[model samples]
Target: MFHLLEKRIAETFASCIGSLYGLTVEVQTEQPKHSSFGEVAVPAAFQLARQLKKAPKAIAAELLSAVGPIEGVAAAEVAGNGYLNLRLDRGYYGAGLLAGESAESRMSAEKIIVEHTNINPNKAAHIGHLRNAILGDTFVRMMRAAGGTVEVQNYIDNTGVQVADVVVAFRHLEKRTPAEVCALVAGPARFDYVCWDLYTKISSYYEEHPDATAWRQETLHAIEAGEGVEAELAHLISDAIVVAHLNTMWRLNIVYDVLPRESEILHLKFWAAAFELLKERNAIYLETEGKNKGCWVMPGSAFRESSGDDESKVIVRSNGTVTYVGKDIAYQLWKFGLLGKDFYYRKWHTYPNGHEVWASTGQPRNSSPSFGHGSRVYNVIDSRQSYLQDVVVAGLRALGYEEQAANSIHFNYEMVALSPGTCVELGLELSEEDKSRPYVEVSGRKGLGVKADDLIDKLIEKALEEVTSRHPEEPEDARRRVATQIAVGALRYFMLKYTRNSVIAFDFAEALSFEGETGPYVQYAAVRARNILRKLEERGERLPDFRAELAREAMARQLAEEDCWQLLLAASKAGSAVERAVRSGEPSHVARYAFQLAQSFSNFYHEYPVLSEANREKKTFLLWMTDYFRAQLEHTLAVLGIEVPEYM
Candidate 1:
């Protein structure tokens, strides 16, 4: 509601200024430094002073006279060197809050495809992978709350070097046949965990004997050719690992609409189609000399200015195998429905929510939902791949899809590391130098990072201890369920509380803390609100039908009070916060808003004791305010993918 009022005020000023001075400019709104000044302040007159060749105060006086009254605005006054200070209609604003209107109302028919959690299907998901998946999933939730038709895609790099390395480990290190590997995948053993260990062993083997790296090349060829035991075993291992990755994500309520596999890109000749387009458009050229001889390279200018061919990116090698960026180019084109080819889709998995996850296949199913062809695409990747992401977008521009290239967003974030304290908690041996540093980086190749499941299990165990202590006589099953919810909430919120570009050295002590700026803190606020109503019911007092009992006049009368007004205003801004977070492409904004709202509620909870109120009318009003806080808190938590436990 605050967001809408701000926009309406801005637009009104823009119209008034344009009509009065015959000038047009973008109007920006901001809050008053002190709440007593007004609700929103605009500085349009300052910008007009330059063009009008008049003092800002003179221009502001004239604009105020020319601008008419705005709906839901009590008064627009000139203040502080031509700034427009606008006060809201308190009665109307309070009434609107009770009506529960959406603060943001952007309706779009175009589809938005968000591709995230593109972990290599070779080993277990690590802490770094958790950061990516959590950020992506939370963004998806935000988009949905903002009323977007979104498709979540999880790109699988089955034919990439990571999957090939695992295959090499199976063939050379473990010396396992295709049948034996299939049995391992089908057995009760954790296949991804096995590959996690084998991957590290293969890394060490390569370091000891560099010549043994040729197996990677051989395995790559077999996988690309889609023939013989190598390809068969590659599919089995990658498919099984993909399921394992999905299960790991599912524990945190992360689900996907499709899994676009690299093998399908090769098998369905997506790269060949993209290659011809690139060649025809001269986006790539065959080099006949220099270090890049016999390679297809895109000019360096597409990504950055260069002095010569050395800066150009290689799309295909001398052996005619396509590079990773080349494959990415094909995938990008398909995302925009420009590849002229589509992946064959089949049912991969159905989540508990009844959402069907589809995967790319060599053969099409009889009935498959249309995938891809999004107006916008957000590829959630870490900051390390910024240069590569640039190259991929450059390929799109070179192919003449300038709009699609521009719409292709790289929602990049920094990597996640473990704090030194967290490393100690994980039982990792730290050197004195490492202990001195703030964080310790984990390497998947060295099998040093904590697995996602292992970390989740630890959080649950810790949460369970807290839960058990809080409710000693509670049923065992209920305690475990509540613990799991709190654990998931803590993990997701910790991953989301940081800005995208900020590196996080995750610490369990900070995340699991229930007191300050944590998920559990915000969640406990909601539970407390609920507990208030529950206590009222237990005391044999029927819950008030707020809609019938609390009239708009009654709400306005109470909201006129300063303390009550502030808390109600804070609780009503959740929708506005969500809109801001979605528009800025930052989930941290939502987290910050949740924390602020929780703090406001905490203050309100202390200041106004609803159950112990002396007056009947005031008590009913306080109860209604508590109800509003609970509803809004849950709505905001849902956007963060955090669930409120029944007995947290």
Candidate 2:
């Protein structure tokens, strides 16, 4: 149990060393490092030793002796490195796990908002955008598993320079008006793919002439004011391209609760109100002197490594227009409920997951769906923007809303780049500058990247080949359905496997692998477990249900015996893994848990006789264990945006 382990450790530490500063042992969960080690481990002794001025060995010895007597611990031993390692009572753990009471009972629900996948509406999505959506969506699922209320937001840059650039391309380059483009969009050629090409051409042309930047500025104003022809064209472009983004994300099983547009942020005067508040409090001041004359500034950003936190940054420029930093500060404050402002929201569409993708509008409605005022806001962005995001939080503190600032998070992730071979596969001829670099950059400005949908198609096609090879007799529709799930698992897990800070050098061949340490591997494990249950059902031995069977087996005196320890031990640690996975914001725990669950099931499968066993009671118990893992693993995989194929 999550609480059981923590409680047992707390009792042991408190009872043995009550004299040692009364430091409570709130948790006994392992800080998972290498897999060769057991499922759970603790280094509490090291900390206790440092605090108590005792040798770590002696403290571990004391703690192990003190903790071992507590229930559910199969063994508690001090490791050679002064780490206190604890193993669970397996049969006890596994039996309790099957009952599902442990995790259900140990949860405190809190609301969390995860905003991600704010892909610019100007072009087709790429693998870079995939990383953001995959991670954000997975985190939302994980929070719910931990008994938290999660609100998923997908930010849309509908009025940004990127979208404006696309508008410029259609009007300036091709001379097509809004109505002409709308009529053509009703016909064949993919609207987003067309926009992608047009947007890229405009980007390249922008490099040739500096004066072209004026069109972008004018479009931004027109977008704000809701002006004529070009704005209508922009609206048509944004609407059609968003459909493209949705289709691509649907392939990966990612969905959003809301889609907030940047235009609404401006039109609603969100930044304007936030600016007034900052100016009133002197959190930001009007700089009438120096090169920043007539501009407003927020004195310091938190990420200025060696600089004092009290330093300031500019909020408004000399032209009286809000800078990017100012807009972000306003957004962050609104997210945390510090800004006395709100949006007029309209339901855009219902996403696949049964949640509404509500869009914000400038004018207030008589009644609208609630938005903003989150207790926590996690902005899933790339590491490059960490500097600016920190300033958002800093601005809050500067205005005396320390709690709001504390709740603002920069959930930074590294950029995705293409591997050399995969780069060439995209039909780009390599030059010295390209081949010599370790990885290829995905430049959105130049449109040099693999489209997200294209990658999903490739992954699905490859999976289809493998699935058909093994199940050639299956119906075409059945195979199609299974292929989609496998492709999703492959892509989602591939996106999550690396730590957020590590660069993902995207490789098609590597990501498509169905073998070890992949999403397909996790799916394969669950599929095998499903097969066992199906086979058992065919044999007329119905799979022992979750609790009824486990309750019956709990009476068996063999559970008190030493040999039953391993199964219980494996079962008991699920809660700990659940807690750690969320606490650390890492999916590897879920990955490792899925692998270990499968591994344990396999070992039990090999060791225990089910249909062949003479001991009907023990066979029933074994089935209970198998069913327990099957349920758990399926749930865990679901959390990672993975599906367990029935036949695969």
Best by lDDT: 1
Report lDDT per candidate. 0.90, 0.76
Candidate 1: pairs in clash = none
Model 1 CA lDDT for position 404: 96
At residue 381, give the lDDT of candidate 2. Answer: 91
Off by over 4 Å in 2: 19-45, 50-68, 74-91, 103-109, 287-294, 300-314, 545-568, 602-609
Model 1 spans > 4 angstroms off = 424-438
Residue lDDT tens for model 1, 1-648: 888888888999899888887778888998888777778898888888888899998888998889999988888889998888888887788777777765556848689999999999999999899999999999999989989889999999999898999999999889999999999998998999999999999999999999999999999999999887788888899999999999999999899999999999998999999999999999999999999999999989888866465899999999999999999999999999999999889999999999999999989678899999999999999999999999999999998899999999999999988899888888888889999998888888888788999889988999999999999999999999999989898888889999999999888778666668788889999999999999999999987777776777787788778888878878988888898899999999999999999999999999999999998878998998899999999999999999999987
Q: Candidate 2, residues 515-542: lDDT per residue as tens digits?
A: 8778888788688777777888788877
Q: Name the weakest run of 10 consecutive residues (lDDT summed) in model 2.
A: 555-564
Candidate 2 overall lDDT versus native: 0.76
